[model samples]
Target: MNDEPKSISIKDIAEALNISIGTVDRALHGRRGVSEKTKTRVLKTAEQMGYKPNLAAQALKLNRRISIGVVLPKHISYFFDPLRAGIRAAAGAAMGSQISLEFHEYPRIGSGDIEALEAAHARKYDGLIFLPGDIQRFSPLIRKISRSGTPMMCVGSDAPDTGRIGSVSAHAYISGSIAAELLAHKLPRKANVAILTGELSTLDHAEKLSGFAATLAIQAPHLTLMPTLEGHEKPKEAYRQALTLMRQKDRPEGLYLSTANSIAVIEALEELGLLGKVQVVATDLFQDLATLIKSNKILATLYQRPFTQGKVAFENLVAYLTRGNLESPVVQLAPHIVLRSNLPLFASRISETDEGEPESDSLE
Candidate 1:
């Protein structure tokens, strides 16, 4: 009574097409030494036969396991925690395959980062995903790695001039422009604005500041720009600098936080009783920041979608290694503006705790 056709196999495909099994295998798996005409014929024949690859069997056939390395800074736990979770989730989904991930965390983006990169290079991983701290400082190392023919994907920031294979991140420049637009609309005509950013050595922070400044210059020419304060991504230092800035005779009327230290800045404002006096536009999302947004202490924030960035960075490297499909050199995801009206939607998505994992659902 059973009339369904039997499953197709490589041997079945080869016999049906009057070709050798080895030739069929090479063509199907996209291996070298197979002619174009022969590959076309073999693929067409396999398709006609309703063939499907047995992934378990394919895994067994693979003799070597693919290895990938991820290097990131540990100081910025708020951002890197979700990023690591995303990579882990992706690795779990790919458990069936023989892919292993090695994570390397550094204290900051200087000597420690360089050491991690060198160690990963020495280990000879099939692919690497990293948060490049300073393009100029790391470009030499990156160039050396590229010369060895190992694929590298920059996650968070980019080093275009250094010959990186690709990069996955939110558009930092656009995020800054959005902040500028929001502040320009909220503040007075001649309001003084100051920027608090991480080190300018990093490209992402630099790009964000540049975009914000450029937009303000064009859109709100009357608003005066103040000297930037480098927080160095330290909360205590940021708090101190913010306090000093707020106590000045002609303190800034608007503050643009280009980093993820909004809490420190807000605390300083609250201490100075300037929380409601100054307009604030910040980057990234956190529980406290969301609360402030709801209470009107902070105006809005641009969500960077760090989870998606991490997930895509790992997936792209795996795809390049297994299928020879190279991703675009620069994959920039658009930033989402979260205001009081739509804060609830994003609040549900952001992690409640600092080390908590992000939601499994894909970001919009």
Candidate 2:
């Protein structure tokens, strides 16, 4: 007979304001040690959201500290750093002092992901979050972890067949399709376009390559698709291969760097004096990439929103762990296209504040 709205709690208020629950509790109770500014904001938000505190539920939730393990790559700091920030930001806002995050970092994607993953699995934390370098290689272990009744959240990439709970990443296929369409319109004279990817073995990279090829064939038949180059996400290898590709007699007129490792490839283009000559669509954004986009050296970039991905992955994993929110197993966020005209909008967020190392947040 009664169908009414659920009462708002301190957690909801904390999440809305992106602050700790303890701070909200302190502010709402007129307790000492909370800033006046924060107290005023909390009161305003509580009144606006129609807060009805449940003291018993708040005390019960605060008694348990959830331990979470985060495993991600260390090589590509440009993308992974913001991702770490996002996770930390989410944990701080939602769980406050009731969460313990143990971040484990490996050398690169393919190099040490498995070892770190296995070690994290051994710990048997409340939930696990990681990026899968090779889906096949990670599937068995992920399946085992899943069988152990642990929830795992994959970020940046996915192991679909594995028994992991879910994933949060960019739309890899759409990212490639956007790049192909951009290049097709940029170069309409039956020119050659090449894709420089990290490793096709990875699902994300393979999907991007496939989408680019399929779209290029359908949208621009005049343009020839060159053999996809794999850099293994190594800076030196990418630079060397880029140099070799650019120096070829029949070099591509357009290039799609489908990984965040564009600086080295861009450097190679600069060395070969092909910055303006060749149209480039890079993946992800950084300060240098923004400058290049502004100068017309790079036509545009696909902003993958690594910070948002990390934040979403953490939030989703926590939700599933606490409330069994497993409605969507895979969460794919759309990519943003950044061009010369709109480079200023992302300039502030792309600025590097720290070294972007996940090891800094380690529990050990």
Candidate 3:
């Protein structure tokens, strides 16, 4: 009465099919020299036999190590910390596969991002997973890296026009539309709405704004739209901008935060005694933002699944390096809207952090 599960082996499949072991190996691995008919037969037989490749054993047999570099912005810890944790967790799970992840943090945007990209290139890592600050600005570098035959995967943000291998992120435009749709059902008629975001040059932020504006136009035309306030990914900057916007005679009745600086915006609203008065829709979930949503101060916040994005980005790059499989050109994760009713369920999973490490203005 053995309780251990039985393992399927290639040799067993080959013997059962009365085919040479070499032929079975080539067909199973998708290598050249295997006829399509034979390949199909091998796959069908393998599936019937419940064949599962021993990834660790395969890695040991190869006797090779895959090195990947991760470049991300550390300016906002609430978002990127969970992402980093996910990458580390995935790397730990792949311990026997000999995959190493080297992390490098840069400023949220500008020349610092370029310098980090350059440093990553100089290191000649086997692969790269990065969050692009500005696609147009980094197009050339991205192209150069791709032309060098190194695989690159974009995380959180994408450089689609560039020759990067793939991307993993939330559906930016759809997320924006969700925010607009949520606000439309909650806000008063003829309410004024304003958006606070990071740089518009970045693809992610720009797409979010575009989606939000389009959805609002269709679903909530009564809500007045105001010009965007650029926060530059800084809490203090966002606080100042939020304060200034609220002071105006035509202060916004609804606020949409397209970046991860909701804490600053909430603080500003609290200071002006408008925390519960003005409806708010924010992006990403941190402990503070979750608490705000639970208290009904912030209307709702979108959870982008940053941790899963990081893990997928690393896994995709590793797959390309080891098996030459690019799962897809872009992998967009769906976002979940968290409101007061659902805050308790998501509270334990929130990326709880008071503050991130200090950031510098320039790359050192």
Runs of candidate 1 exceeding 4 Å displacement = 1-63, 325-327, 352-364
Model 2 clash pairs? none
Candidate 1: tens digits of C-alpha lDDT, residues 133-189: 877789889878966767788998888767576788888888888988999999857
lDDT of 1: 0.80
CA displacement after TM-score superposition, residue 326 of candidate 2 (Å)? 1.8
153-203, model 2: which lDDT tens digit per residue?
Answer: 999988886767789889899889999999999998978999999988899
lDDT of each: 0.80, 0.84, 0.80
Cα-based lDDT at residue 358, candidate 2: 24
What is the number of residue pairs that collide in model 3? 0
| Residue-level error in angstroms, candidate 2, position 245 | 1.3
Screening candidate 3 with a backbone cut-off below 3 angstroms (N, C-alpha, C), the clashing residue pairs are: none
Candidate 3 residue-wise lDDT, 62-126, digit = tens: 78676789988886887888888778777887755577679998867664888998899899888
How does each model score on TM-score?
0.80, 0.80, 0.81
Q: Which portions of model 2 miss their true places by more than 4 Å? A: 1-62, 353-364
